[model samples]
Target: MERRSHIYGVMGEFATPEQLTHAVEKVREAGYRRLDAYAPFPVEGLSQALGLKRNLVPLITLLGGLAGGVGGFGFQYWVAAITYPMNIGGRPLNSWPAFIPVTFELTILGASLAAVFGMLALNKLPQPHHPVFNVHRFSHASADRFFLCIEARDPKFHLADTARLLQSLHAHHVSEVSDD
Candidate 1:
């Protein structure tokens, strides 16, 4: 019925981490949630500024590690007690003590793998392209510039108001990002 462009968001380029952080706080205070920041290096308290807490990766890792430990122990128990039922002189059929090492190792391995995968999934990695890439200045995001993007998907996002807000925040430049 109607054509709509795949506009991802409006981005603001900042000269310093403090400026970006202040802009982020202001945006957050202005009730914009679907936003992100990019910078040349890690900036302390950035996550706090963005109101990010309770990351799920650690929980994923814990559950995966527990599953691995249980699976490993159960496999060993099955092999010793159900499948083969090997018995040495006065030794128990299910030697749980010996199984602990393998179980622990598998637990660590599973946790590590889960951490990696969970982080990837959380960050939505393997994405070949993103709208932010359309900006010529965005390349400097990996160098000395700091960038903040307020996504169109955000319920609070209005093109004119968002651009105005970015300008009020003293952004060096404000540009729209297209999904294409």
Candidate 2:
């Protein structure tokens, strides 16, 4: 584990979602993309303010559903026509109509399962620890406060300048967040 850092970035605490939202917009306009905002509840237009446009979960789910549907249909066709041929009602060997229900059901199931797992994988969930937790009052982010964290990795980041910028946005308090 290599460690050499006194601070992670600057975190600005805000009392309202509006403040947080305005701060995020300003930060984005300031050409800082490495930032995260926290709020007690989902705020309107936050995602837009952050310019988060791409979402891959739905695409994953759709591909999963397609695979399931095709697999279900193929499996049934192979089973009834090749693996175990049984002519109960003299139906055609490649019985596509009979496979429809199972195909639909498996498609639904696969889509739902993919949505759950794909979202977790894409977002890199289950992160039990992070630098933001070092902030003493950050816990209130889930209670009644909003927070904006501008990471040091951003090209526009400068400790003092970022702090001053955040303050200029009317932050209630700006804290020097650490990674240790």
Which portions of model 1 miss their true places by more than 4 Å? 1-4
Against the reference, the lDDT scores of all candidates come to 0.92, 0.90
List where candidate 2 sits over 4 angstroms from the true fold: 1-6
| Clashes per model (N, Cα, C within 3 A) | 0, 0
Q: Write the per-residue lDDT of candidate 1 for residues 95-130, one digit (tens) a residue.
A: 788999999999998899999999999999988888
C-alpha-based local distance difference test score of model 1: 0.92
TM-scores, all models, native as reference: 0.90, 0.90
| lDDT: worst 10-residue window of model 2 | 1-10
Q: Write the per-residue lDDT of candidate 2 for residues 66-168, one digit (tens) a residue.
A: 9888888888999989999999889788878878999999999888889999999998887888999999999999899999999887777888889999999
